[model samples]
Target: MDPASSIVTPASVPDPRATETVADLADQLRQLRLAAHRPAPTDNPLTLRQLAVLTGLPHSTLGNAESGRVLPRVEVVYRIAQACGVPDDQLPWWTAARNRVAGRRRRAPHPAPPPPPRERRAEPVPDQPILADDLLLELGGTAVDKAAELLAGRAPESVVAFLQRLHPALVAKLLATMDPVLATGHLSGLSPQHAVACLDATDPGTAARLLTLTPVTAAVAHLTAMNPEAAARALAVMPGTALAARLPHLDVDLVRRTARTMPVEQRTALLTGAPLPPAVTGELLFSLGFDGSLALLRAAGARVAARLLTALPADPAAGLLAELPARDAAAMLKQMPAEQAAARLLGMTDRQAAERLAPLSPRPLGDVLAHLPVPCAARVLAWFADARRRAVLQRMRPERAMPIRWHTETATYRLWLPTLATEAATSGATSAPTLAELATAGPPPPALTPGTGGPAATG
Candidate 1:
């Protein structure tokens, strides 16, 4: 009989029930591979490398499947059988053999019962291990107080080492009695929980200093675990940048309480770069009251002041802008994009927009006005008084300024011309209002006809 034919007998077919061990399964897989007919120069029917290409499994994995020491997963067995050209009808037989071996191994008893479960022990109290008989005797059992007294005179390293071993509450008391600077050094070495306890027992300023030295994430955790009022007090003493960095991670209510306790300068700092949500920032500004909020904006410098103002409600923002000194308000507006400045101005009454923007130099004012809709720009300009309006228009490049000037003329005509015409016709007056009289007339109408501007409207 041909060698391949001999390998393909009924005895060589993998029988799932007979494959009780991984070695039996591996032998069946090898016989399957050997019995497969494939083009090969050597006696082997298929090389492992060729099988790898056909199956898309690594050669090493293919070798391991037939190594007998380990049972290949059923999927691997199926893939290898398919690559070997096992008849599709027989693929399940190979897979079943692998599963039978796997199931048998799972059911096999352990060589020995699991070592009996070890007994669990109670956690010892914090200072028990470190408290010596002599030390206990020296303090008459007032360990925390006596420990503080003894550690006070020691070197910082010694204090840190001694405190690290005690209970957090005991460490907290010991730290309270030490000089703050020395205590902070020891606190830095303690775990976060212990550090928090010490900070809670200490004054805010000292707590703030220690926190500044701690990593930002760890410092935030310590603050979150501290009493809210105590945390707020600690935050009050931190530098603005450090405080800003920490506040976003703290709970919002805690931050609100912190804001209430912060000085104006620190609050300004907090608002400047802290990544707080807009609503929280609005609430913080509101808690400052109008005057305090104004002071914060003024002190926050132009750029930040502009940002904070934009976040306020329209009415509050307009009121704040109205309250700012003309130069300061103009400077804040200049810091904003022209479109943003125009929108802010548009939200205000004409007189309010005029007052806030009047102090801006002609060039910037024109730039801002350019962004306003023609009718809105013309109305705001009407409140600027004639000379200021003319100066702002002249400062704009001609092409840009022409549209506004024409719209301004058209708006003026629309507002006063009809009334003047009626008055003339009714009273038998001989002429219409002069250009100067029309230009100087009461504020331009709030809005003009949307499409009503051209040489004809200008006339």
Candidate 2:
């Protein structure tokens, strides 16, 4: 008490922030451990066997730590982390508390220091990176055959980009997930825009890294050709952009099939078609992370961009089109069969779009088009190439196209303006219908309440 008191002063007393009694802490920890499927001494709250299965660590290891016989080893600590969904970094705090209660004082372990810089051994030559063939062995795929599938397919530009980026092993692993037809479809879709050197000819390690970012179709090819060591290395360090550039070249069909498998930023990057720098491409995709892809397409700010994106494959294409402004939406809407555009417009958050759309009837269309969502939507509409839109609008039947309006909320009806125009314009009399005639059809389409989705509407 005298020695302890000498070190303690009233103002500077060390408050043992370790406030919980060691025994209490240990008991609490044990309960948590049990609930985490890493029960101390193997008594799990859920079930002993279940706990053991969850941790993947031997029960004896955990048991030895709890009975105060031995401190748990790093192995058990990691197992606990997995079972409890705790991060590895939190181990020190948990273990510190555990030991304090047990009254076990031991020096903290330190990692072995790196060998003195000069003493490092030199790496040898003939260290050709391992091939894709070897890596595929681990996943039970045939590298050569897999490679053949890629080469045979009509891959897209994007698919080629993926092939250029991934390591042999990773490619093999990814290919293991595809069937011959799917692989062929993916390859067929690809355009292979990236230079073969940035991709196919790179060392295996880089290839592996790139492939991590690449789509399944592209990576499979060169990866199948890689040696094991090189493949592994490539899988470790390749950039995603390298993978992205390869994809745009792929066929639309394959991209649609494989897009869900890759991250959104990568998908967007591919869709951007901006000729991004490798660094920028990787950065763009990486920065977006996962959720950025879910964001609106208008977020990109360029109408030309949103317009260009319209040409992408369905899944990714639709996602891009989603962020467009109203007029742009309308422009796009007018291009499609009324049903399709209306369906797409249905996904928007523009609360007043319903009212604006009320004038799908040319008689009412101007006012509706006036309040349409903006410079944003207008920018998109500017890109409409309406001559093109009008051509498509001319193909439908009168009954399907006139007086495009939604009268009943009770029933969800999509009044496609284009359908009406198509039907009216193509109705074909010596004299074409006037704009006024088209706007106020004397009688609408049977379902559209006269004037809509009918031949007279376009007249």
Which residue pairs show collisions in model 1? none
Backbone clash count, each prediction separately: 0, 90
lDDT for every model?
Answer: 0.67, 0.39
Off by over 4 Å in 2: 1-28, 34-44, 85-92, 98-104, 107-400, 403-459
> lDDT tens digits, residues 236-294, model 2?
34355455444444343333334444455555655465554333333334345434643
Which candidate number would show the highest TM-score if scored against the true structure?
1
lDDT value for model 1: 0.67
